[model samples]
Target chain A: MAKGSLRINEISNAANVLLNVIFILLSFLCIYPILLVIGTSFAEETYLNVVGYKAFPKVISLDAYKYVLSNAKPITNAYIVTIITTLTGTVLSTLMIALYAYAIVQQGFKYRRFFTFFIFFTMLFNGGIVPWYIVCTQVLKIQNTLIALVWPYLINAWYVMVMKTFYNTTVPSAIIEAAKIDGASELKTFFRIVFPIAIPGLATIALFMTLRYWNDWYLPFMLTSDPKLSNIQMYLKRILNNLQELLNSSSAAMQAGSMLAVVPREGARMAICALAVGPIVLAYPFFQRFFVKGLTIGSVKG
Target chain B: MVKTVVKQLKDKAIEIKKKKSFFKDLHDNREYLLMIVPGVLQLILFNYLPLFGLILAFKTVDYSKGFFNMDWNGFKNFEFLFKNPDVFTVLRNTLGYNLIFIVTGAIVPVAVAVGLSLLKNKTGARAYQSFMFLPYFLSWIIVSYLVFGIFDYRLGIFNNIISGVFGREAVNWYQSPRYWPTILVLLHIWKTFGYNSIIYFAAIMGIDSELYEAASIDGAGVWKQVLVITIPSIKPVIVMLAILAVGKILNADFGMFYNVPMGSGALMPVTNVLDTFVYNALKINGDIAMATAAGFFQSVVGFVLVLVTNHIVNRIDSAQALF
Candidate 1:
């Protein structure tokens, strides 16, 4: 029996080693492509043409970065647009969702069921894309503007549902009752007592909204034709679609004649990609925990 | 008789209080009512109003006539949609790809989650998870750049390997339709498996360790333990995910379909799904009626699928049902 057990232990140990190797390879697969992007960004433009994108730079150069920075007007504008939208959109959406969710959860609020059902009904059905597009462009008249990006995504039904779940679990009814008994008004009770306690939940939702706003190209692609209003994602998309456009319009000075011979076409494109995703990639670890927490809680119930 | 009269009077007073409570409740929770006004208005503008706009599907919309007033064209829009042979191809690609995604999406994540659970090195597992989760943060636009870098005919990584290693002519991947289905599914998995795996991993974590210990002591091996205990424990999560996928079977991730292929015209036969189809019809072809009809079709079917899936799940496990 001892010998048989020893054999089994040996087999299990081998299996464990095998599992580790497999997972490490999988992890490498996940991360290697990003490394390729980063590598190609630093690569010399001439070398990039001769040798395709590699896991490391073929010949190290900062020409791409210099080129991108020298013509900083569009990139700067896009960055500003992205930042403004992310901050304002996240704050507004989180507050609106929290208020709406909080109102529905109040025990004494007579229209709680009606209000809850109103949002929940959206989760089951929508009038699809065409009608929604018409509503935005025609009726709301929000096309080709900053408001287009912010307004449409302000109240996702799923986010509201998740916020409702978060509020139900996090903010105990007894605390609200205690605040009410102490003569706190409904808004006061929420702002003073409940809001402090609901910060973690709100933070999770805020992070999600931030990511959504930061990463969205769809709203810009659909709503705006103007280059000035394009966010970072949309800007990157424009570059990806037409590298020749970027090469031709290197700078206003360069646009006077054909100076495409020296343009870092390949390197500049990857550099822009690297720049666009740099913030998210760096800040990922800090926010990833909250995302996991939100996912677990949100999925377990809903 | 006097007692009965008094009781009847008391009941009448209670009835009147109940009747008056609507206004009383309105008066009482007026603060909360004020709180939800902005959200409700936004919801009405964005969500509810669009339902009314589904009328555009049945109408021959004229820009000069305005949105609210249009000629009733009956089934003409839908007829235009169905008459196009391209519609069947798009429909097939949408359903086929989604069905494949549903299967692979369920299996791969669960497998990764289970594999992570089995590892003895907790730190290593966490590192693997973080690395995997990194891709989810990338927008489809950025991912398109990565895909382009890999698939660009002259300078792409794949072309380098193909021509350099095999001594063959470098193929233009952009022009190829046959390779797209595989490319798309793999890309979808690569982008999403990390996030999806985390959900399953959390579910696996929730399972009691004692059950595993008990099975081990019963001389069940790792594989047996997984088959007998771990999978069954997380069955509800697997089922719930599958049902949700089924609910959205008609819908494709529009960004993935649009961006990854880089809008290459040659790849349209394989890459075009319902969302992209509607988009092309509306934007490129300027066929508003046809687009509206397709969008309306998707909405009604998607809504029914949700209801049907929820009903099925409710019958099986009420706790796991989305509703």
Candidate 2:
């Protein structure tokens, strides 16, 4: 019986080893193609065409990077637009959500349920895209403006709900009462006391808001036609789509264009993706514990 | 008469004091209210205000005529959408793809998560989890590029290996509709399984270890313990996720379908869903009203489905209902 048990343990250990190997291989698979693009960008275009994308370059070259960086004006513009929109949108949205959440969670507020339902109902249903597009273009009149980028996604219902739950759970009732007794006005108390305490919750949601803004391509795709107002994702998408068209165009000039495009196509895309995710990844470790805590606190019951 | 006037004045004073107390209550809660104002205003402007634009579905848009001055078309736009053959095809594709996604996509992640959880080493498990999650961070555009690198007829690794080994002809993956459903599903699972597994893994983690200990004490093996304890503990999450997915079964991942196929017309039959179809139609016709009508139709149907699903969930188990 003891020998049989030992055999079973060995089988399990082997299975575990196999699983780990598979997982590690899968991880490499996930990261490989991305690394390929990065590798190909630095390789001579001629070499890449001859050898195909590889683990190591046949001939190392920075010609692509040079070509892409040479026409760096548009790429830099895209970066500026993306950064500004992300920062503005995240801050505005987080502040608004924090306030709305606090108000709805207040027991003394007479309209709390009404306001909560008003926000909650939006999550269940919405008017479709066409009407929304027309409203923004016609009524809001933000078609070509920078505000268009920041405004549409400013108030997220789910975030508000998450924030409200955070407030209801984390903020001690006694602390709030003490603030009230000290004759601290509601706005002052919130900014001074509640805001500090809820930083963990706020930071996680801020990261979410930042990611949403940075990753957003749909709004710019649909709402704005002006190249000047385009975000990085949308701009890159355009460049990519244009490349496909150029590849199919069969013009002599386009053939020349293709060589020039190949470098930027690889480097620019990787650069944009890296830039978009860089801040979030940097901030992630600091907020990792808080994010898990906030998600469980806000979501488990909901 | 003098005595009566004095009593009336006293009553008035008491009423004034109550009003003062009410205002004072508002004053006391001012800080909390201020904290919530920015979030509320942003939502109102961005989310709520755009909802009013739903009215434009009833009108024929003329750029010169302006939004309010546009010709009223009653139900004509919606009629046009329903009348189009493309709408039916799109609706069928959307529902079919999503159903496949929900069923298969749901199962694979749970299985993967359970398998991972069964692994006993702390270091290996954490590393595996992160590995699985890496794909979730990537954009669909990036994912499409990766797919291209693998499946490209000229330079794809698949063709390079197969032709070199077996002397087979290279396949053009994008033009093949027959292969897309499998490809799309596999890709979807690859991209999303890690994220979905996190939820399931979290749920599994929450299960009391004591239950597993008892099962082991009873001489139940690992598989038996997983079957008896782990699966049962995570059943509620699985059910909840299923119901939520059912609510939006009419929608497909537009980015995945549009980008991965890269507008290869040959693959449209299997790949085109409502959103993509509507996008194509809008591109061709520039008919805002028709697009809005279709969108409105989707929203309504989707809303009704969510309500029905939630109602059913409530009936079966009140705790599981989203509301």
Chain B only, TM-score of each candidate: 0.92, 0.88
The digit string of per-residue lDDT tens for model 1 on B169-249 reads 998999999999999999999999999999899888887777777777889877887789879988888887887788788
Over the stretch A255-283, how does candidate 2's per-residue lDDT look in tens digits? 44466645334434334444444554566
lDDT, model 1, position B132? 87
lDDT of 2 by residue, B136-247 (tens): 6666766666676677676565776777657988777877789888888888888888777777777777677767767777888888877887787887788778877887
**TM-scores of the models, in the order given:** 0.93, 0.86
How good is model 2 by TM-score? 0.86
Best by lDDT: 1
Individual DockQ of the candidates? 0.50, 0.32
Alpha-carbon DockQ of candidate 1? 0.50
State the lDDT at B320 in candidate 2: 71
Q: Give the candidate number with the greatest TM-score.
A: 1
TM-score of chain A of each: 0.92, 0.83
Give the clashing residue pairs of candidate 1, or none.
none
lDDT of 2: 0.72
